[model samples]
Target: MNKIIEIVSSLDTNQVYAELSHPNSGGICVFFGAVREFTNNEQVTGLEFETYEAMALKEMNKLADTALEKWGLNKVVIKHAIGKKEVQEPVVVVGASSAHRSACFEACRFLIDTLKETIPIWKKEIFKNKSVWVSAHP
Candidate 1:
């Protein structure tokens, strides 16, 4: 398929390269959002992500379609993980493949930035002592 979009409990990077690889594509760009150990100097234990799956999936498909049309992308993948994620684990992955570097690069960035702005995913920062719900946009 030309597009892959899903909200998963776990993310697999091994499939990404193969998924985005196309004979006509001269360039592929990917962005991964991972959990960090600290946020604003506070020690973070992990993060929790929750989303309305149906809505999120629909929004993701829309974003992927837009990127594909706007950039003439050969392939596109948009995925996000839910539930608790430890530091260093990938929370989201966005990628694009096109005939040239610029299109894929630009599309990759647009897929991620637009996804953050439009998707209904919410994240909670897990601190050593407590958990705080951050903005839903991330």
Candidate 2:
């Protein structure tokens, strides 16, 4: 499986991870980041996400490439949602597959962690009382 980077208006975690199967890989690790119902005791109703799509897409592809080069993984998939999402909806999904579980896990972790640290997506937290722009990273 090659790197698949999708920055779209919505996301399906299952669909994102479904394509990561590889004959050479014995294990697949996946991570899904969803809109949490609470944040520091505050109730979160929804979230709005946006990005410089072109630049974000480019950065995501680079991150996927890095994960492939840095880890012993056979596949990497990274996808993120744009626009509004209700609670429990997936905001991001990442999957990595390899001959061993550890590599798959590490690659998945690195792909998401690095993406959060370096990507250009912006998020707005929608609370029951108010909404504010927040860094999509972290």
Candidate 3:
């Protein structure tokens, strides 16, 4: 299965892992990005995420294609949460499965790093006394 993009208010790791699991897949790698409680020393109350949906999906699909081309992986799953999210909530999850552990790990890392840099997503950090909008990328 190749899930290019999924936008959900929440994600389930078990569901993602089950979807990627296969008899032919010898290894699976997963990466999760979560909302932190603080930013630049300010306490965060929550976050509101927004995106250029069409472009974001396009970039995500491209990421999946690149991973498959580079790693010859069997499957990839990318899930992202949109809308209000509280501290500790998962913001995104990437899963990759392959015949070997090396490819799975590499592809998972590549997918996440590329998505953070390339995806057109923005985050508004709601602090205790103020809020600020910033790029989703690191």
The parts of candidate 1 lying over 4 Å away from their true place are 136-138
Per-model tally of clashing residue pairs: 0, 0, 0
lDDT of 1 at 92: 99
Against the correct fold, how does model 1 do in TM-score?
A: 0.96
- What is candidate 1's lDDT per residue for 1-138, written digit by digit as tens? 899998999999889999999999999999999999999999999999999999999999999999999999999999999999999999999999999999999999999999989899999999988999987357
State the C-alpha lDDT per candidate. 0.95, 0.86, 0.87
Candidate 2's displacement at residue 105, Å, is 0.8
Please, what are the lDDT tens digits per residue for candidate 2 over residues 34-120? 999998899999999989999999999889888888886788888999999999899998899888898888888888898888889
Candidate 3 has a TM-score of 0.92
Poorest stretch of ten by lDDT in candidate 3: 1-10
Tell me how far the alpha carbon of residue 106 in candidate 2 is from the true structure, in angstroms, after superposition. Answer: 0.9
Better of 1 and 3 by TM-score: 1
Each prediction's TM-score versus the true structure: 0.96, 0.93, 0.92
State the TM-score for model 2: 0.93
lDDT of 3 by residue, 1-138 (tens): 566478777777668778788788999999999899978888999989888888888889989999988998889998888899999989999989999999999999999999889988888999988788875357
- Best-fitting candidate, scored by lDDT: 1
